[model samples]
Each structure stands twice: as C-alpha cells, then as structure tokens.
Target: MADIGGVNSFRSFARSWRRAASFAEVIPRRPSFVLAPEGEAVDDSSDWDMDDGRSHIDGSSEHSTAHSRQHLLRGPSLQSQGSEAIAAEFSDGASDALLGGSPSTRSSIFDVPPHLAAADVIGSHSIRYGTINSVRYRSRPSVNHDSPWGVHDEQIDPEAAAMTFGEDNPILVKEVKQGDKVVLTVEGQSTLPQSVFNSINAIIGVGLLSLPLAFKMSGWIIGLFILTLTAAVTAHTGKLLGKCMDYDPSIVTYSDLAYVAFGTRARIIVSALFTLELIAACVALVILFSDSLSSLLAGFATATSWKCICAALVLVLNMIPLRWLSYTSILGIFSTFCIVCIVIIDGLVKKDAPGSLWEPARTHLFPSNWMSVPLAYGLMASPWGAHSIFPSIYRDMRHPHKWERAVNTTFSFSYALDTCLAVVGVLMFGDGIKDAITSNILRMSDYPESLTVVMCIFITIIPLTKIPLNARPLITTADVVCGVHREHAHGADAAAQPSALVHGVRALIRVVVVLVLLGISILFPAFDSVCAFLGAALITLISIILPISFYLKLYHKEITTRERVLSWFLLVIFSILGLVGTIWTFLPKQLVAA
Candidate 1:
C-alpha cells in the first residue's frame, strides 16, 4: 500500500510538470530548463507528456524510478535525456516570442535563458541557473531586461507594426519615388503656351491684310483666293492637330508642331520670309507716319524734320513694353475706334460734299478701279494669313468639336470688319481714296482734323503692336535651332534653363535678322510694291501651298470623303489663282497698260 501511494504521488507531480511545460512551449515567454536535487547524477529518461488517465508510472521499472529519484538530488545538466526535453521546451517558447506569439505560462516557473533573452545576443554571455524551491526554481530576467528596471523597451504595438511592415513596405515606397521623379522633371522645364501661338497668327493676319491692296485683282478673284487660302490653312491645321494628338498632347508646342510639319529646312525658310515681311510692313508704317506728319505739320514744320521726328517717335514706341499687348486688344481698341470715326466722318461729309460719296461709283468703270482691286485683294489677304494662330486656338479649345465654332467665329468677325472698311473707305474717299483710306482720311475737307488725327493714331498703333508678333516666329525658329545644338553640347537640363545665355543668343539673332530686313526695306521703300510682291509670294505659299502640302503629307492615305473633296478643291483653286496672280503681278506695263 505505501509503495503504490508513493508511485501515484510521483506520477501526479510529473503530469502537472508536463502540462505546464507544454503550455509554456506554445505561449512562449522565455527559455526554461529542469534541475535535479543536490548531488545525484542526471537521469536518462526523456521528459514527455503522457495520456494515461491515472498519474501513476507505467513504462519505467522500479530500479529506473529509484535512479531518477536519486538523480534529482544533483544540479541539472543538459547532457541528460530529461534535461534535453526541458531545453527543447524552453527553446520552443523563445522561438514563439520571436515569431510574435505571447510568452509561455511555464516561463513564470523557470525564467528564460539569459543568453537567449539578451538584446545583444551576438555579444552577450550565456545565461546561468541557481535553484531556490525544494522542487527546483530559477529567477526570470525582468521584462525590461534590455533597459534599467522600471524603464520599458518601447514595444511596437500591433497597429503600428502592421502599418509599417505590412501595409507600406514596397508598394508605397515605389509610388512615392515615381511621383518625386516626375515632379522634378516637370519643374526643370519651361513650356510655351497657346497665347504665344495666337500672337503669331495675329502677326500673319497683319501681313495678309495688305495682300488685296497690292494685287489688282477682282473682288470675286480675291474671294476665290481667300476661300482657297482658308481651306488650305484649315486642312493644314487639322493635320497638325492630328499629329499633336497622336503623341502625348502635353508634349506638343508651337515650335514642335512647326518642326513636325516643315522640318528644319522649312523653319529656316519661314524665318527668312517672316523677317522680310515684318521689315517691309515696318517701313510702310514708318513712311505712312512720315507722310502724314509731313502733311499735318507742313505749315508749322519742315517736311524732312517732321518725318525724322515721327520716325524717331515710332522707333521709341516700338522699344517700349506696349509692344507686348495682345494684337486683338490693340486692334479692337485703337483700329476699331478709328474705323468708327472714319464712318462717322464720312456720314457727316456726305451732307455737305453732296456728290463725293458717289465718286467711287463713277470711278468703278474707270481704269483706276483696277487699283481698288489690288488694294481690296491685299486687304482681304490679310485676315487669311492667320495660319500660325491655329495651334494656339486649337489648344485653347476644350475639344476638337469646338474647332469649327472658334475658327468660324474668328474668320466671320474678321471678314465683316474688312468688308465694312472697304465699303466705307470707297464711299468716303470717292476718287481720292488712292492711298490707304486711313492715310488720306485727314485730307478729306469735310472731316474734322481731330477725327483724322484719331484715325491716324489708331492706324499707327496697329503696325506698332505687330512688331513683337512679327519677331516671335523668327525668335522661335532660332530658339529651336539653337536649342538643338545646346541640347547636344550640354545636357537637356542645361539647355532647358532659361538663363542669360539663351536669352542673349535669341536677342542677337533677332537684331541680326531685323537689321537685314531693315536693309531690304531701305532698298524697296515702295509700300505698294512690297505689299504686292509679299502678297503674291509668301501669302500664297503660307496660306495656299503649305497647308495643302502638309495635309497630303500627313494624311493622304487616310483622308475621308469630305476631306478628299475639300483637298481637291484647295489644290485646284490655289494652283489656278496663285498662278494667275503671280503672272498678272509680273506682267510688263506695256502688256496690260492698253
């Protein structure tokens, strides 16, 4: 009876120990070990959980039990099979903690191994053990083992750990890096806007306005040319718009569009043509101002001195910031006001000058009427020179569908303005409107000098405002050409910088081109002849030929039915009208004088 009781007691203790160790292994607090009593050698039996209902020993013999009891008197060593099992349990607990599980409950009975728990395991000494309880006991290192007592190692809470390691690891970092690179590239570059393109178009418009005035052609013939010019320009612009849309729309600029259409050689040709046109226009403006001043101040000042002063004044005005205003604004405010004044003066004059308003009608059958044809032709051609504006306007429009509306509005408004001016000028000047009506408006005896002065000022402002617009295409062409060289010699970043070097080079090119143009103007001061030649050559080339050529080049194979019909019409009309105008303008006086 005594022996059986002792066995049952030992079995109960072992069962309790196994249960505690198993729980500790899973929960994972710290490293654990088993110890024997004071002086006995270590037993060889492996420590394990058993499933028997009764806690009494079943596998071991009586001799083995005695040996295990005797071994309990000595301190534990890991060499024993039972000690290995205990070490494994503790190791399991430590691994669980590292993998983010809670500390094991069994760790409360035997503290974790010091070596395993130390923060700097790579450099720290291994843990040692000392017994306390009669059963065997070990002290646990405090949870704050890495720091001083009462000083906690800041635990990474579940929420923060999950956010940092789980959520934002690779995905967020990649996204942030990409965003940063894009912003840096965009910030480093400068882009030109649609407004700049619109100004270029307005400059072209000024040049075209003089076309009809210079080509002694019929209104119907001029109208045909205008229609052909419009169709060609529209087709060309549509093709460019298509190209721009093909790439990323953001990458397309006016300069890029021009380069895409005409290539590098075309840029040079266009630049030269633009320079010549501007200089001729400027000279015409200067002469018109000089002549007006000579006539207005004839009694008070010498014609030569007045002309010099007026020329100097115009030069000074051209140099000022007023040159930067939009062409539409300048014309709308000054030119429109002048036209209104001319109409008012003409209306008032008709009351007293009785038959003068009909004078133009009488001369309609005369040879002088042929002069009006050229003048009207030049005037009509002016509005058609608005090709460069297409890119600007196209970009501004919200959608391609809006293009027709915007273009039609602009053209219709321009045509109305031109037609009204022509009719009013012919009626007001009668036989005397030989020169530009604005110029001869002051000479009309029935009109007040104040009105004429206003008219002169208004007309003067139109040409003055156009200087910057005229200079832009040349500047842009030079910029693109030089920019290419700079990009190759330096890097893209260096070339992109709008520094003193870029501005200086651009300015130098402008000065050189303008000087060459000024030389041409001096050699050919006849406004009528310059306007005629320019109208016949550049206006036809830009408005008629270039558009057709570009459209065919860009979309010949893909043209729709409407586009095909329009293209054919443009080709035929432009060829016929351009050829006739060229031939007529070049004919000798003896051939047509009869």
Candidate 2:
C-alpha cells in the first residue's frame, strides 16, 4: 500500500512537471517590428523605451549616441521583413514570452537592415544609425564626471558587436544622420557584483528600524515567520518584474511596465501612486528627522518648531543640484549598518530583563492581540519594499540573467539584518519595544550616552540627506508639468540651459514642496504609523501585487496552472492584508473597543 501511494505521488509530480513544460513551450516572445527597407522612414519611438521623464536631447548626436550605447537592450529582435507586419508589441501574442535560460540563449539579436536608421529611435535620447560591418562607434564618456547614472560602455570584439542590431533591440532615441555611415553606439553593462551592491542599497533603508516593533506587535514567532515569508514573496515578485522586462527590454521604469501591461490607464495609476509615495516619504523623513532630534534636545523647543527648522535647513541644502550630493547618498547604507550595530551591541551589554526600561513587559511567542497583526504585516513589508526601482537595477545590470541571484542575495542580507535587530529587541523589551528600536535603546537605564548620540545623529542626518533625494524626481516632474522644462527639439538651442525665470520658478516650487511636507509631518507626527501606512498601502501594491498582476496578465496563457494558482493566491492574501492594515490605521479607537 505504501509503495502504491509513493508511485501515485511520483506520477502526480511528473504530470504537473509536464504541464509546466508544455506551457513554457507554448509561450511566444513579444513581436518585434519588421525590418523596413533601407531609406524607408518609420516613426516607431512610441513603441519602444518610451518614458514620461523629459528627454534630455543635446543637439550633438555624439552625446546622445554615447548615452544610448551605455544602455544596450538584451533580447531577441523581430526578424520578419515587411512593412505590413509592423504594429505595437503590446498585443497578446507579442508580449507572452516564456522566461528562462541565460542571456545568450534566451535572446538572439539579429542585425537591423542599414536603412532602418533613417527613422527616429527609442533607445536613447539620440541614436545615430550605423551599419553593422562599416559601423563607426565611439567609446563611452568619462565614468567619474560625465555618466551620473553610472554608465560604462566598453569596447567589445567587432564580430560580437554585430549581433546587437535587431529591430527589437538597440533603440535609437534621436536619429542623427551624418553622411550615410551608421554611427552605432555599443554600450557596456553593470557587472554582477555592481548589480548586487545596487540591489542591496535599494533594499536596505529606514524601514529596518521598525522591524523590532513589528515583532512586538505581531507575536515574535509570527513576526519571524512573516519576515521570512514577506522576503520570499517580495523577492518572487521582484523576479516577476524582471520577467516582465524580459518580454520587452524597452520597459525601463515601473511606470513603463504598467504602460506595457494595461496601457495608458495603468501607467497613469502607477505614476500617480509613485508620486504620492514620494511625497509621503518626504513627509515621513521630516517627522523622523524632527523626532530623533527632539528626543535628544527635549527642552530646546516645541515639536512643531523643530520640524519647521529642519525643513528649512533641508530645503536650503536641496536647492543645490542632485549631482552635488550624489556622493553623500552612499552614506545612507553606512548609517543603517551603524544603527544595526548599536542595537546589537546595546542589546548584549544591557542585562535588564523584559520591561525594565519601560512599563512591565514579557516576551511571548504569540501576540496578545491578533487585531494588530495586520499592522505588523505592513511593518515587515517595509524593509523588503524596494520593488519600485528593482526594474531599473535589472535594466542596468551587465548580465541580466543573473538578476535572480542578485534578488536572492539582497533579500538574504536584509533578512539577516532585520532578524538580528528583532531578536535582540524582542528578548529585551518584548511588547514594550518602541516603534523604532533605536528609540527603545535610548531609554535604557544604563545605555551608553555616546551610542545614543550617534544613533540620533544617524536618524536625523540621514533623513535630511534623503529628503532631497526623494524630492528631486518630484521637482523634475513638477518642472515638466509647469513648463519650466521643455521637450525634445532641433537646432543649436535644443540643449540650451533653462532661462533665469525657469530657475526662479524651480526654486520657488522646491520651497513650496518643502513647506507642504512640513505641514503633513506636523499633522501626522507618528513615525511608525506613517511607515506602516505607506508600507501597507503603496509598498504592498508596488512590491507585492502589481508585479504579480503584470506578469500574470502579460503571460496569462503561457504560464502553468501551478504558477497561475500560486500567483493568484499571493495576490489575494496581500491585497486583503494591505486593505485591512490601511483601514485599521484610520479606524477610531472607540469603534475598536465596541
């Protein structure tokens, strides 16, 4: 009987595997544009690498060409040759590509016919069409000073370079035709190590500070389970995003991916969500900066006063361009590491049992109140909520195939760091843990004063630096909306600098934005609450639901039953969790008592 059961189980597994294999075999890569005859002009920039961000077009095709080469798209191009076959690749047959295999196998870049270069391209701001064998490409610009986005285009063997010209690959942003000779820009890519470093940087942030409290709110055991579960699920969704990008290497940003999945409506919704998230994040930073500083200087001033002062300081500093502070951005990761070390060291040195630092407390395996578990869900989700930019990191990678490994490494490191903090906090404070573990550490009866000062400095200064980083994109978006910035144009003035009026308006807008952030922070001063709400709402949708939905939507027919089932299950679970947590956050305490 045992042998028969074993055989039956094996058969079931084999059948399921076959079903998956069949589905994989049936999916088709998104259709690419058919190659037009040489000299036949086509306007297809809208079909590829389209972004909402204003294109920075310099009249010099050389600069644009250099930029395009740094961002080479790796995927199979459309091999069909005909004028009638060109259509938007957004259709079902064109978008349903199965994902697997290395970059070399999963993609084959066919040479684009020489004449296709006459049309406007989509890969970079400006692309000069170059013929394969006779192509004259330039080396990438200086890495240290020119490429702020960290682009590097190294020279490859000419024979190997010829394979990157399929119609579906290497988009030309602005076609600069100079005497028939195609000027192809072959760009270099970010290596596996660089990609891993970037992914780690994105994943680790202020959110880790809240994990200790998350464990306190949910049962420590439940929190541990939830942390592990959230990491795995979020990483899976990140991979889904990578798969979506795989279908069309042109998908550069989260909003771009949305546009691919459900058209204009999806793009608008995702873009709006991203904008709101940025504003909310700035508000949170304001509160965090003020909160940390006020804790240290309790008798100095009112909380509202502290917030305004900080906002003013940050606004003044942010008026300087992002490039000025680009180097300081890396300090964010170091600050987080330092905070974690302080928490661990303090947790070890302090011999106090649960509740000694505050009110009576006790360590528990389960939460006393299950109602708070959803909030914990949001809190735990925060640390793994960097999915908004995962697509960007994936696109920048030299070996796009190693994206899964990068995601795994990032999550593993984050999980280990979060777990260490949560365990120490739980063992020491239990339910009494503050929203920020650092806050709880500061209250310890015998805590080191020097360490408390250092923790406070990290909390305050780091947010100050981040506020501008978060606000810069929003400011640029505002500039476009207000016409302070212009679209792509021709002539010597195409790359002309913004006028004085434009500069004045930009500075005014930045001030208004900072003031608005200050107002919101003053109104909602709870750091944990802000973090939880953002995590529950925006982060949940961005990091969890949307990626899965987009992937399933794009590859609906091609995906296996198991894949579909698992995806839907995760979708339902997280949707409910986010919704419940968001609603609970605003519910009246009186209603809860009833």
Candidate 2's residue-wise lDDT over 1-594, tens digit each? 322544234333332222111111000112112111222222335432223111212244343334333223222122122222223321322232222332222211112221121121212112222222223344222232333224332333322332333211322222223332112211214456666666776677788788878887787689889989988899899888888876644454576566556654565577677777777777877777776766677778877888998888888877665434444555767888898888777766665564232322576688767777878887888777678777766765645778899888888888898898777777667767777776666655477788888988887767777777777667655655565643322233335677889789988888888888888898888777778888889889989999999988767866899999999999999999999988866665344320
TM per prediction = 0.53, 0.70
Per-residue lDDT for 103-189 in model 1, tens only?
A: 111111112232223223210221122211122112222233421122222222222222222111100000001111110000101
lDDT for model 1 comes to 0.39
TM-score of 2: 0.70
C-alpha local distance difference test of each model: 0.39, 0.60
Relative to the unseen true structure, what is the C-alpha lDDT of residue 4 in candidate 2, on a scale of 0 to 100?
Answer: 52
Candidate whose lDDT is highest: 2
Window of ten residues with lowest summed lDDT in model 2: 20-29
Off by over 4 Å in 2: 1-188, 354-361, 486-491, 494-497, 589-594
